[model samples]
Every structure is written in structure tokens, then in C-alpha cells.
Target: MAPSLVAVDQLTVDVITDNVSDTYASKPPFAVSELANIMQAGAQEISGTTLLVANLGYGLRLTTRQGSKEHVLLFDTGTEGAAFLRNCRNLALDLGTVEEVAITHGHWDHMGALEAAVGAIVARRGQGNVTVNVNPGMFNERGVLLQNGTIFPAARVPTPAQLEAWGARVSNDGDARLLLDGHFYYSGEIPRVTSFETGREDHLCRRDNSEEWRPDPYLMDERMLVVNVRDLGLIVFSACSHAGIVNVCTEVRRLFPDIPIHAVMAACISAA
Candidate 1:
């Protein structure tokens, strides 16, 4: 059965870090660009210092409201600390209010600034005040195959113990459950069922230093964060969509067949 979810009156997604920062492009009424956000945060003029840094990574600050109550969650933390921290500062976000964090996958691009972020949060909220959600499968060392046929290992995400040591209450269990008073649905292992949406063959991983590198194209550890908004429906947030957005949406559909999917916010790659 689908887990019970609280219907939020509104949802706001703040893009703290991403691959691009195109503020001049046309956007929907419900959408705001980087420049607008910076200016709204009291930027006098649009300059290098005033603008948010764009990096080869992704991160989002999700804020949801249900009547008078509000909840905030962090999804991923981008590829590094400097860029992520700079962007957050430019946006004037108060990480202290963040109640939980949900890492979409094990990729460094999605979790590189995790320690820095947790430090910021814990600095204001105090030790062990925030919860970071993750699964055990994501702790393995991952790499990519280069064109020359050599493996280029990626930076590993911090261990659960490291996160705990850094003042975050790490939830390392692999279970689909409601989070932050049911305002968000943190999915478990996403099932891959799409035909053409096969994962990247260059991806590889090793359980430990003793284990040999093996193909890890399908990142089963990848999960999606879903928010049920009042009158609108589900707003799914997939970090890299390494599990394939189709499979991600399919799993959401299967989970809540009665709810309509309002939108999917993520970095989508074309299968074709």
C-alpha cells in the first residue's frame, strides 16, 4: 500500500547548485531564475560576487508549507564545498532551518559538500539535530571507464559514521518511508524497467579495497524524493536520475497510483 503523505499547501525548490545559471531565459510564472533569486535576497547589482556559482553538480533546498506549518529538507549537496557554500551564501539561505537531508545517490557530484553542509546546519542547530537519509549500497567506491580503457575513480561520499561524527543523525537504512512529518517520500531502491534507458556502461564500483571493480551501470541505490502538494499532486525530485527518470516515475506511479504527478525536477538525459 502507498504510504500516507501529508498534502502541503505549497512547495518551493531552491536551486543552490547546478550545471548552469541561465537567468535571461524565459521561465514560467511559478519559476524564478538565479539572478532574480539573488536580487530578491538583497543583491544591489548583478555581478560575479552577487551571482550564484554554477558547478558540474546538483543540489536543492526544498521547503514545504502546510497551512501555518513549514518543513525544509536538503536534497544532495553538489560536487564540492566552496561552490556549494558560495551559492548558498549568495542566495541567503539559512541552512539552520533544514530538518533533514536526502541524498539521491552515491555520486560525488551529488554529495561532495555533504560534510560542509552538515557542519553549517549543525553549527546553528547544534549537534545531532539534523537527520541525513541514505542507503548502505551507496557507500561503495565508484569509478568511470575512460576512453583509453582505464578506470577513473570518483571521490567517495562520506561514510555514515563520518556523517554521524559531523553532527548529523544518519539514517542509513534502505527503506521507502515518509520523512519530515510525511511531507516527503524518500524512495528505496528504484527498479529499472525501461528498455532504452539502460544505465551508463562506463560506470563501475567496488564494495571494498579487496573487491575487484565491477560494472555498476544501474545505480540501484538511487532514490527519488516526492512531495504531495494540495490540489497539484506529486512533485518528484530525482538528483542525477542515474536510475533513469522513466523508472523513477514508474516507481512513483506504482507507489501512489491514485495521485497525479504534477512535475519532475531533475537533470534529465535523453536516452535517444
Candidate 2:
């Protein structure tokens, strides 16, 4: 059965990490720019240090409010710990308020800073206060084959044990479920049905160090996040869309056939 998603009155998405910092880009009335957020956070001078770091990764701090209640959750952790933490500090984000951390996939760029992020949350919220949502398929060794026939291995995300030791209650389940009291829906695994929306052709992965690199083009482990906003419909957040954005939206529509999709946030293309 589809989960009964709760409607939130408002949602705020802070781009904690991304590949670009578009301070001058024209945005909707509901959106804010990097410079505005930084200055609001008390930046006197707009230097390289005061600005948020742009990297080859993605992360978002999602906050939702319904009536008198508000919930905070993390969608991803970006590529590195220092940059992720630095952005958090620069934006004056309170990691302590994060009730849950849902990783969109096992890619290093998304889960690279798992340890540091969880540690920061645990330091403020205390042990076992936050839950880290993940799935089993995200723990494999991944890489990409180069033109010269050599495989460039990507850094593996922190193990489940590492997350537990860092004071996180890891919900390592593979099935779709509601998160943070139904304010968010963490998908199980995206089904690829689009003909032209094929996945990455160079992706490779293996179970362990001894296993040979096998084709992982589909990235079957990738998942997406969804939120139902009051009067606005659905807001979908697909971190990298290795499963394809069309397929992601298809899944969303299938799950909530009556709800109109308000918007979709995805790192579908890399400009860097």
C-alpha cells in the first residue's frame, strides 16, 4: 500500500552543497540566492572564504512545517566532509535540529561525509537521537572505466558500523517507507522504464575487493525523496537521477496519482 503522506504547510530547502553558487541567477519570489543567505548569516565581506563552497556533489537541508510542528532532515552529504561542514557553518545551519538523514544513494559524492555529518548531529542531539536511512545495495565498491581500460575506483561511503559508532541509528532497509513522521518519503529503488533515459554507460561496481568490476549502469540502488505540500502538490528531490528524471517522476505520479507535481529538484546534469 502507498504510504499516506502528510501535507506540510511550508517547506524550506537550503542548498547545503552543490556544483555551482548562482548568486546572480534570477530566482522565483520564494527562492533565495547564495549571497543573500550568506549575508543573512552575518557575512560582512563577500570573499572566497565567506562564500559557500561549490563541489562535484549534492546535498540539501530540508525543513518542513505543519501547524505548530516543524521537522528537519538531510537529503545528502555532498562529496567531502570539510566542504559539507564548512557550508553548514557558513549558512548558520543547526545540524542538531536534523531529526533524520536520508541518503539518496551510495555514490561517494552523496554519502562521502557520512561520518562527519552524523558525528556533528550526534554531538548536538546526543547518541541514538537521529536515524540514518540507507539501503543494502549502497555499500558495494564502485568505479568507472577509463578510455585506457583502467578502472578509477571511487571512495566508498562509510560502513554501517561506522555510522553506528558515530552515534546514529541506521535504518538499513531496502523497502519504501515514510520518514520523519510522513513529512518525507524515502523511495525503495527506482524502476527504470523509460526507453531513451538509459543510465550511465561507464559505471562499474563489485561486492568486495576480490571481485571483478561488473557493469552497474542501471544504478538500481538509487532512490528519491518526496514531499506533499499543502495546496501545492508534490515536491520531488532526486539527488543525481542515475535512475533518470523521467523514471523518477513516473514513480512519483504512480505513487500519488491524485496529486499534481509542483516541482522537481534534481542534479540531472553536470555543468562542471
Candidate 3:
């Protein structure tokens, strides 16, 4: 069955080359042609039900859909990530038409260009309102482990109020008030549905001034955008599936038992 709604887009990743020159000293500088070649070399694309995964160098953009509404959820905006933003703008995909913006797991790479996304939406839609969903506590109190097991300070998590101050409606915690349909249908706490799904043990966050580090667990962070099409079945969109893909699938199945999963799109792999 064809879904009543469509999340149209693709994920593309590009490799950036930094050249070390006196003028561009921070990292490295590369000629426009060289950069273009690097970008062409590292590009990858994937398509699924509710997500259009695109890898723009340091970060990823998961464009989701629900009925006729569309939202572009960003994961890791990247540090000094203007190039990625520009790439998004230039892509065949239209960022101007997005309905909302969500930040997945606070980190500079994930949240840096949030303002840019808002601005682009404004430029395209003109003074329109949008929702920004995030779990600020993920960063406000904990740290995360990199691929090498090296611990890094958690990125400053932004509150819904903070995002609201910047003209966005932030959806924090497990609040479902901002949903277009106002239907709280997802199954309770993921990770509990499957044994393969396990939270990250090395990820920790600090609550007080003390040096104590608490496991991030990325609890509420497992949330994803689910779209139920009249005919096309179900589409699930994810940022970083820290909660485990199997668990996420289980939750989706539990929520919409009759809706077959037509596609699954994600950014990073918690457990493949």
C-alpha cells in the first residue's frame, strides 16, 4: 500500500579536505576544486519510510514525515559547520518546506547550526512557527564515549525554553503535546522490548558541580518520528539509535501492530 504521505529525500555524506596554509590556519585549507572532489568521493545515500538520511560531512539530517506534515530533524550540526548548512541549502531537497527541526543528542556537531536551519525555514516559509524536539538532560548532566572509548565532555544541552526564545517550540522530556495529532501512541521506554538493544555504558553526564559522572544511557533520546500512511504502512525515522535498532523496531511494532514497517532510516548505529 502506498503511504498517504511521503518523506522525499536522500542521505548524502561528503568527505572534506582541510589544507594547512597560513591564511586558513585553524585546520587546513583546500582549493574549491579540491574540496569539490573530496565531497564527491565520500557521498552516500539511503532511503526509507519516514526518514531521508543525508550525511553532510560532520553531521546528519533526518527528514521525517507524518501525513502531509514534514520535519527536518538534525543530528550533530557539526562545529563551524557552515559548509554543511550550505550543502543542505544547495541540495535538490528543499529545506524551505520543512515543518519542524529536532536536535538529536546534544553535541556541538549536532546542534551548532540550529539557528541556520531556523533561518532557512523562515526565509522559505516567512515567519512560520516550528517545533524543535530534544532531550537537554542528555548533555546537561552526562558525557559520551567516542568510537575509541575516549570520554568527552557532554555538549551543553539546550532547553525547550531556550529554543522557544529563539523562535522555536522545543519538545523536551517525553512530552507529546507538540505533536500535530496529539496522539501519544508510542510504546513505553524502548530498550526494554529487545535484548539486543542496550544503552551506552560509557556515556556519562554531570548534574552538579561535583566531578561525579552518571551514565548518559540516552534515555528519552531513543525517540523517533513515526508516520502512519493510509496505505503505505509505517515509516520510522531515527537520528542515532542509541537505544538499539531492534528495540526501536519492537516499540514501533507494539504501537502500530497492524502497520507493517515499510522502511527504517537512521544516522549512527547503536547496534547493527
Candidate 4:
């Protein structure tokens, strides 16, 4: 079946997890607590110390409302269930409303809280079908080889069966598609076409348990999400753009030449 191309009426993004934090809210937008007050979330905890602690991971809770229909998509879980779940609770977010989960890559920091998130969703859904936007390339062991020739093992992500057991309908594919009635555009395997856009160095992976790590710079499983807002044009969500942010943006332009990219929500930019 073909994916939908309809633009959403409104898009609201909540950074569920990320490496950098701005709880101080010294700028135009105050902290989540103050924002909650503006949002009328009085029941939630609002304290100086109750704010969420930033982690070396990325997760975004996005809600796109088109007319009367509203949908939620969890883009990548944080380092672990504990941190992400805690933040969700503190924020008083309704995980039950999430219908889809999109993973960006196979790194542990990006997918560690997947099981906990699925469990929460199923608990609220009560046998509900939550579609997980994923690809088969993420189900293997991955690592980074340091300059010392030592392999830094990464925490393995949940297997397909494990995700299914946690009540997830895995949508593993190689081509891009739209989710929630075209509210989101999920990119397939990103091609490394840029000459200067070099990928992560020392990125290695092992297929079998006994196999050794090999150079796997372009993580074939890495994908991105694009939400076309009514007036905002396109909001590209590239969490851990291992394939290169420039390449990701270029693809967006190629796909939608008519629309202008108003904003780009990228993650894991500390190294850069």
C-alpha cells in the first residue's frame, strides 16, 4: 500500500529525552514546569528539583493533530527505561495515546528504553496494536573501535520478538512510508551520496555472537522522520543522524522541492 502525503494541521513536539537540557528556561520559553502552567497541567509536579535530568541519549514524544484526529509517535527511547519513564511520569504524559514508535538507529542510547515504553503503552492500550516503525538492520550487535584498538561494546537493543512480546507490531521495511495517515514520513535506508559528508569513524558491527567487529560506518538501519506541518512546512526529526545531517536535509529537499524546510530537530550534536 502507498503512504499518505497529507500535511498535518498542527504538530507539537516534546523532547522526552536528550543530551542537552534547558530546564532553566531563561529564554522565551520557560522551563517545562512553567510551560506546564501555561499548558494548564496543574496536576503534574512542578518543582525546582523535580525537573528532568539530561542524559547522553535522545527520545522525542511527538503529537500531530490534523483537524479532529490526533496521533502520537515516540521517536527513539532514551538510555534506559528508568530515565525515560521517570521523565514521562514527571511530565505527566499519556503514553497510552502513542500509536507508533520510530527508531532512528541501533545504538543503545537511542533504544534502551524501548521495552519499558512498549510495556507502558500496552498496559494502557489493553491489547492495543502499537506499530513500531523500524528496520531489520538494527537487530544486530554494534560497537565503536577506539584508537587503542579496543572495542567499546554497546548495549544491545530489544530484538523483534522481544518487542513483539512487549506488545508491539513491528513494521520493519527498507523503503520510506507514511504513518498515522500521512502525519509522518518515515525514511528508509539513507544513501550516503555526499562526498564531504563522512560517516562516524571506527563504527563497527558483528553479525553473529562469535564474529568479530567489522567496519560498518553507514548504519543501514538508520532512518529519519519528517512531519509536514500546515504553516511550518516540514519539521525533520533526525535523531543521531549517523548518515550525516547534510545528507538527511538534502534528501528532504529532494523529496519535497515545493515546500521549505522551516525547522530541523536534530539530536546528538555534542561531538560536532
Order of candidate numbers by TM-score, starting with the best: 1, 2, 4, 3
Candidate 4: residue 185 Cα off by (Å) = 0.3
lDDT of model number 3: 0.51
- How would you encode candidate 1's per-residue C-alpha lDDT over 1-272 as one tens digit per residue? 35479989999999998888877668888888888888888899978899988788889999999988999999999989999888889999999999999998898989999989999999999998999999999999999999999999998889999999999999999988899889999998888888978898999999988999999988889889999999999998987788888888899999999999999899654341
lDDT of 2 by residue, 69-175 (tens): 89999999998999999999889999999999999888999998778899899999999999999999999999999989999999988888999989999999999
State in Å the error of residue 187, model 1: 0.1
Looking at model 4, the pairs that clash are none
User: Which whole-number lDDT from 0 to 100 does residue 256 have in model 2?
Assistant: 91
How does each model score on TM-score?
0.97, 0.96, 0.63, 0.91
Q: Which lDDT value does model 3 have at 184?
A: 16
Would you give me the overall lDDT of model 4? 0.81
User: Candidate 4 — which residues are off by over 4 angstroms?
Assistant: 1-3, 25-40, 43-49, 269-272
User: What is each predicted model's overall lDDT from 0 to 1?
Assistant: 0.90, 0.89, 0.51, 0.81
- Which of 1 and 4 is the better model by lDDT? 1
Better TM-score candidate (1, 3): 1
